[model samples]
Target: MPTRPRSSSSARISSAIVVAATLVAVPPAALAQSGEVNVYTYREAKLVAPLFEAFTKDTGIKVNTISASSGLEQRIATEGANSPADVLLTVDIGRLKEAIDLGVAQPIKSDVLDKVVPAQYRDPNGLWYAASARARVVYASKARVAQNEITYEELADPKWKGRVCIRSGQNIYNNALFAAAVAHYGEAKAEEWLKGLKANLAQKPSGGDREVARDIAAGKCDIGVGNTYYWALMSEREPDKKAWAEATKVILPTFQGHGTHMNVSGVILAKNAPNKANGLKLIEWLVGEQAQKIYADMNFEYPIRSGVKPHAVIAAYGELAADPLPIATIADNKKKAATLVDKVGFDN
Candidate 1:
């Protein structure tokens, strides 16, 4: 496996990974930590480095992280009790549930977590908690789309036919959103909505959310569905993407009567975490005000903590009224949502 080891605890390097992949030959004893926590994350190493650095700075405990886009949960399972993974940091409740269902996550009970994160955003069994969130909202073209407000149901209206652009419906982000729709309206109604949304497609569902913005800017579509952050990132960061951002405005859409659907970036305590106490500390500290601030500014996501404000770029979109349905509820509907996606051939 390719390796890029980092030595500094204080460096803001995106490559803050000590060992970026699994250690097969080394025994679990060598992996033991006297004052460190091993983390397996689906999130990019650089995006999560500041949180680890802050945790280490405040408490003097080192963080050892191995980051991957996919299969870290399976890696932990393969390591079994020998797995040194103390905490799993990742985004989306669907993946969090996957960790739990794979038996890689253990239940946690933290008063700090319960108080800092709302009930709707955490696992009821305490297996995981959302540290940050991003809403699945429409990216309407400023030049073409006039309506400032939209409902999830409105994406299906006959008026929007040939105007919607989106990524694959099978994507975890869209899956979670579709699952939320199942929770709000029954699976049957959600199927109808999915079909209608698919009918509105200007082109076959392709590319990630940022590409959806590109298509809207290019006049391939008038509106598209995407997470809140990609637009914010485009607006503030990449000079090349600034045109895509400038051409569109975000609309915080909701279910007919309910609030906007929210997907999360959450954390889980490893089932056989070697340094359980340290892992718990890291988990709790993640929800603390300081870490939440990094999430707001650096990650460009909404802090799940009550008192934390969003980054100004995100705040400009307007207040987000997140749907009260528990993330677990949305997660429970994933299989059903995925089935509906296939049944409707939304990707085709």
Candidate 2:
């Protein structure tokens, strides 16, 4: 993990003195007494909690938080119009789209978000925006595969047969990759790639990205696909993870005319947020320099904002062209991606 720069909380505090003094003249005690907002998230606590803490420390807005990986949409649905959740944070375009489809999240008007995040990475109406991005890069075992030769299509070549390992096609990450395929190759060609790729796998699709790395390190497969950040995450968590990280290197694959598929960890404002003002504040704060720096340092994800470099581990992997297909296309073609997954029997 890269060293975290010192918190710029003082800079924020200096800026807030005038605002805090002005709010002191107001009658409402909500900004001072409770000084709090509530958040619901599907991401890991370590990845997002600090931002809320920083917001609290700077603006005096206490953040009440709940961290869960599943059934968030259902929980929000059950809460209905009475829900206290002010913000929603999570991954994958499908999850964000689900929030939009369910009408659980509301449009947020933030000039900051618009200027910092690309249009393709966010909804036109501002239902949500990506805070950070991860690419679906290939990892090749250092001993078995040489660099610069693998293309997306060539992964299915007969020479590489029984040389691949992947997680379940049902995984949202893989589904998004297929969605990218649909965008670039058309449904016909994308389905062909899925069918062919499925046939080349060395074993049944079963584990997450880190497991894919482990398989490659163990020689269970010579090559595999996974998000670039997982390798860094694993390496940071334990010494045992270093072997897997060292055994393989990241492959950009963007060299073959199309950039690799990418996804995001993003946020949306809740439709009936009890703290709507605070929600927008959070969104604005996230895309700003402070939170963007934390996201890059802690998660090994690329910051969506301009001028923010990737974390050191990610930097060590070198760089490549990202696929030009708009990431929003992933959400639009999601259904087709699923249909093709089924058509090609990808679950087998």
Candidate 3:
């Protein structure tokens, strides 16, 4: 919600130092062109900014971004009848579905979106569609773990006891993974799997996906569950991250059976988006081959569009079967999935 004053480039450069002093002075409209598209997202700013800049370069459209905010839903709701945002981008189908349920997102009627995004990956009503996907899989230390193959239900084996690492169960990513399980097996069986998983923890689930990878490399645990994209990011960003990669082999679970659990970061047009033509144009540009490639390179995720090759690191992980569950199912059952998490004590 912070607004920068409208000024020449030189003045804009100078004001960076006076940001605190300028904070109380202006409304966003005073700073922005009326035709700009506003985006609200949880994606890390570095990962998305360049893409937005590229979109601008291609089309001469201006994008005003608000990244990494916590109260996005409330912000969208508050913008209400007078909302300025043209697009909403966020990770996880849960949030996308929430936007639809709240009536903040309106169905887009783009033929490009329909053809390229895949039928199961998007809302039937077109409230939102994915740009890219990330896989959730297990990582096993090369030095200690000897199993060549494993299943999601096999984590409970006595050999892995006190050696599994994961992030907090409250995270939506983990909840979605569990929901994928629910789709495969009934609730009673999924709860049994959760109980067994808790019994075998390397330590209590405590950190981000990178942290889980770090623990495996540090010899604190032999196996961990984390999103696949983080592995590539870590390997590219820090040398120590490579150590983690070297120590473990990515095991995309359910490959031979149900396929790996996956999730997406996607975009939706606002229900009352003022500039609908520009919005449609922007959506087309995002799902285009060039934009999809940028997403793959920056984040180590798969392009939702077919035939676009993933990044080198992701290719090294090798391809695996993806689950066939309609992604909307994960969004639809998210609340029920959360209740199951609590009922079964995944946090404990």
Reference-based lDDT, each prediction:
0.87, 0.77, 0.76
Q: Sort all candidates by TM-score, best to worst.
A: 1, 3, 2
| 289 Cα displacement, candidate 1 (Å) | 0.4
1-348 per-residue lDDT for model 3 (tens digits):
122334467344433221211201223552234545667666666677778888889988877666533445455666686776677788787778778877888889988999999987888888889988988889888888887677787876676789999987778788888888777777888788788888889787888888888899999999999888888777787685788777788887772367778898888887767666677778888899989999888778889988898998888877767887888987776777788878878777
Per-residue CA lDDT of candidate 2, range 173-243, in tens?
88888888888889998888888899889999997888899999999999998998888887775587889
Task: Report the C-alpha lDDT of model 1 over 1-348, residue by residue, as the tens digit.
Answer: 123444575223323223454322223562666688887777776778888889899999888877766566777777798888888987778879889999999999998999889998899899999989999999999999888999999999989999999999999999999999998889899999999999999999999999999999999999999999889989998899999999999999999889999999989999999988989999999899999999999989999888899999999999888888889999999999999999999999
lDDT of model 1, residue 270: 92
Worst 10 residues of 3 by lDDT: 17-26
> Candidate 3: TM-score?
0.88
lDDT head-to-head 1 vs 2, winner: 1
